[model samples]
Target: MLISAEGRTYRQEAVAAAVIGYRFGASKVRVSIEAWLPDNRRRDVDNLLKAPLDALCHAGIYEDDSQIVELSIRRAGLDKANPRLEITLEAA
Candidate 1:
């Protein structure tokens, strides 16, 4: 699939963030994501999953995205000043 310029940038940043003292082996894991939107515009939380997950995998956070046995995502609220995603991974 084609990733837009913004998406690519986001993935790069995500990978950089994941590589900072964060690493996981080939194990089942749970992922939780808290999304803060830049605006209150309508959006689907599910739409926010792929890029970061893919970025983490690219960063070798785990063996693969399939190793994510459990996943959860929620909108923490709007952060007009700084919209972002807070992702956490742990053994399942």
Candidate 2:
């Protein structure tokens, strides 16, 4: 699939952050994602998964996205002042 420039930038930034964060070895992991939307617009939480997951994998956070044994995503209301995602990765 073709990634737009914005998507590419997001992935790049995610990868950079992952590099600065923790890294887990090849093991089962649980991922929790809390998304703060920029506005009170309809958005599917699932839609937010792929890029960050792929970016984390690309950054070598773990072996691969397949290693994610459990995943959780939730919309934590609007944060127009600072829209962002808070991701937590831990051994499953």
Candidate 3:
């Protein structure tokens, strides 16, 4: 998702943070985000899909390789106070 804030458009990585779990369901569904940084260390966003998610996905993504699966990558925006970059795998 693309977001324009303070006269500037910012990108962000979005992920499912908490999957809705049934009281008796065997497994729950969840959304996750994977953000890659220049340092090689990756940032992961999970269990929380928020308004910033799309922005998040747009923020950090850098490279993607498509073959058997589609991949969208970005930088890392793990911190809520401030975000840097983030990536995501699109829903089929």
Candidate number with greatest TM-score: 2
| Stretches of model 1 off by over 4 angstroms after superposition | none
In the range 26-73, model 2's lDDT, one tens digit per residue, is 999999999999998788889999988988887888878888999999
**Worst lDDT 10-window in candidate 3:** 20-29
Q: What is the lDDT of residue 35 in candidate 2?
A: 97
- For every model shown, what is its TM-score relative to the native structure? 0.91, 0.91, 0.22
The C-alpha lDDT values of all candidates are 0.88, 0.88, 0.33
User: In terms of TM-score, how similar is model 1 to the real structure?
Assistant: 0.91
RMSD of 1: 1.2
**RMSD of every prediction:** 1.2, 1.2, 13.9
